[model samples]
Target: MNLIKYTSIAAIFVSTSLIIAKILTYHFSHSIAILSSLVDSSLDLLTSLINCVAIFYAAKPKDEDHKFGHSAIEDIASFIQAMIIFISGILIIYQASMNIVNHKVITFEKVSMYTMLLSLFMTICLVLLQKYTISKTKSLVISADCLHYKTDVLMNIGIIASLFILKFTHFYAIDSIVAICIAVYIIYSAFELGKSAFNNLMGREISRQEQDEIIAIIQAENRIKGFHDFKTRRSGQMSFIQIHIEMKGDLTLFTAHEICEEIEQKITEKIPNCEIIIHKDPC
Candidate 1:
């Protein structure tokens, strides 16, 4: 929990700082590309705040209302984050279109490029930190926020390139063109992100490899005659598995219980942080 909180706090600081910096540069540059990237950074701050709240909810224990667990909060939060990104993308495209149609002259100094470079460096650092947190927590919110920031990295690169070209060619349209392209891509990615979170909320099955591994583990036990009715579902970072195990009719209830426990232990060893329910049937 501390790790999740700390990671989110770090992200908030980085994104907030970049948003302020980008605003200053956009004021001086009036570069649509810089403004587009600034819009993304602003959403980044909102997403981080959402992630922190989601992580807090996900940490809650199972209660009467939430008998399974509180893991799905992360997925809900991710869906909302995607919607936020989608809105920002649409707004950027509108702003860029207006600027292009108006034939506005975009004049930006080297400071705009320098500002983007600084944002790029900080984003890279924050992504590295997020990678470490994902390795530790396997959090859906963190992963989704990471995806958003990665696009920010690319947006920064495009903005910097556009500024370089505007400096030389004096082409007022270059900034708007780049911003429009970035915004369209952002909208496309937002749809994909939302789809993934929606699937999790709808109780998507675990991966094929994981199912095979579980079957293999059950088959490895000779005393376990057979198995059937296996099921798997994922919520946030947690997996829930259910299976019915077959045993010889002659085996005592105690022995069958022992076998089921052993098999469950093996499965737990293979898949960490999962819930398992096993039913024994005499064959």
Candidate 2:
């Protein structure tokens, strides 16, 4: 939880700093490409802020009113983040289109390029930290936040390239063209992020590999005759698993419970931070 908390705070700080720098760069550059990156950075800041709130809220302990805990709030926040990203992409495309049709003249200095370079460097560092955090925590909000930064990394690269190309060739139209491409890519990223969030919101099952591992663990217990009704779902960083295990009907009630406990321990050992429900039944 501390890992996720720290990572979310770090993301917010990095994104806020990038947005400030990009705003200044766009003011001077007057280039649609810079504006494209500026728009993305602005969205990054917004999403990172949302992620920070969601992470903290999701970390709350379960209560009598809410038995499943608040983890699903992360998915809700992610969905909202996706919608915001999609809208930003559409806005960028519209602005870029206007620039193309108007044949607007664009001007920039080395400072604009330098700004994008700085953004790229900072974003890469954040992405690495996010990657590490995700590996350790498997947090949904942090994962979504990381996705936003990954897109920004691409946008920064594109903006910097466009600025350099414009400096040399002065094609002018290339600025809008690159902006449009970046918008398209942004939209695609939004779609992908939204899909993942939606799946979790709809109670999507855990991965097949994880299911297989659980089944293997259950089968390892010889006292169990069979198992059925295996079910699994993920909420934020938590996994919930439900399964029914069959044993001899003659076994005492205490014995059946002991067997179930042993199986539960084995499953817990296999899948860290998972909640398991084992129903005992007669063969």
Candidate 3:
């Protein structure tokens, strides 16, 4: 269904619309909190597009120029998304600083307040859908995009709270404070995305649980004396596993080939979309 692709397109529309709404709301209310939310969402359009394009490219089949398929592009897209988010956070902080230093007093009318509430409702729905997409696709770019939207849900909540507080208590500084806090949070999310992308690009090891499961599958096969030199690496949704198994020296060539084939099938049956290579050493 190209769930991620479709979802990213949906996200872009939502983000673009909400960002425009927030901009207009901020224009009228001059609420720094709302502006901060706008800044966070401004990156949404770009990030969602990156996810859409990256997933499409990553899913491309192996070709002459790229034998390993195009999966690595997912991490690259995530890295770019992180940088955009970080820049957005910084800009939010700068705006908040200006408001705080200038002692800008902001007032939110019922309309501005309701606008934020509506934005919050829409973000919640998007986040729920994103969760479902991540569950089905298990895609890195989709997962990363989903994670940030979850944060956006929180950022919207903060913006709404600041509006209500300003609408009632008339404490002007609270809006700026809330905006700054949201900005700091956005930066933290950027760091998380950047770190995850970095790890994946660096060929991080797959989870120990998965490695153990692979070992178990190999060990369970009959005539498999033992295995050693097991190694694993991950790129996006793909896993690469390599190992050396020692077998009886007296075994016939046909028997050894049959054993190897059995082990390969067992591993594939247990783990889908994984590449495994096994080297046999006669002991």
lDDT for each of the candidates?
0.87, 0.85, 0.82
Ranking by lDDT: 1, 2, 3
lDDT of 1 by residue, 171-200 (tens): 889999999999998799889978988988
Candidate 3, residues 1-283, lDDT tens digits: the string is 3787888888888898888898888778878787777777788878887777877787788999988888788788888888888888898889889988999988767767788788888888888888888778665566667778887787778777877788789889999899889989989989988897899899988877887888888878768888899988877667788999999999999999888888888887766668888898998
Judge candidate 3 at residue 280 and give its lDDT: 88
Error in Å for residue 252 of model 2: 4.2
Better of 1 and 2 by TM-score: 2
- Badly placed stretches (over 4 Å) of model 1 are none
Q: Which scores better on lDDT, 1 or 2?
A: 1
TM-score (C-alpha, index-matched) for candidate 2: 0.92
Point out the worst 10-residue segment of candidate 3 by lDDT.
Answer: 137-146
What C-alpha lDDT, on a 0 to 100 scale, does residue 153 get in candidate 2?
A: 86
Query: For each predicted model, how many residue pairs clash, with residues at least 3 apart or on different chains?
Result: 0, 0, 0
Identify the leading candidate in terms of lDDT.
1
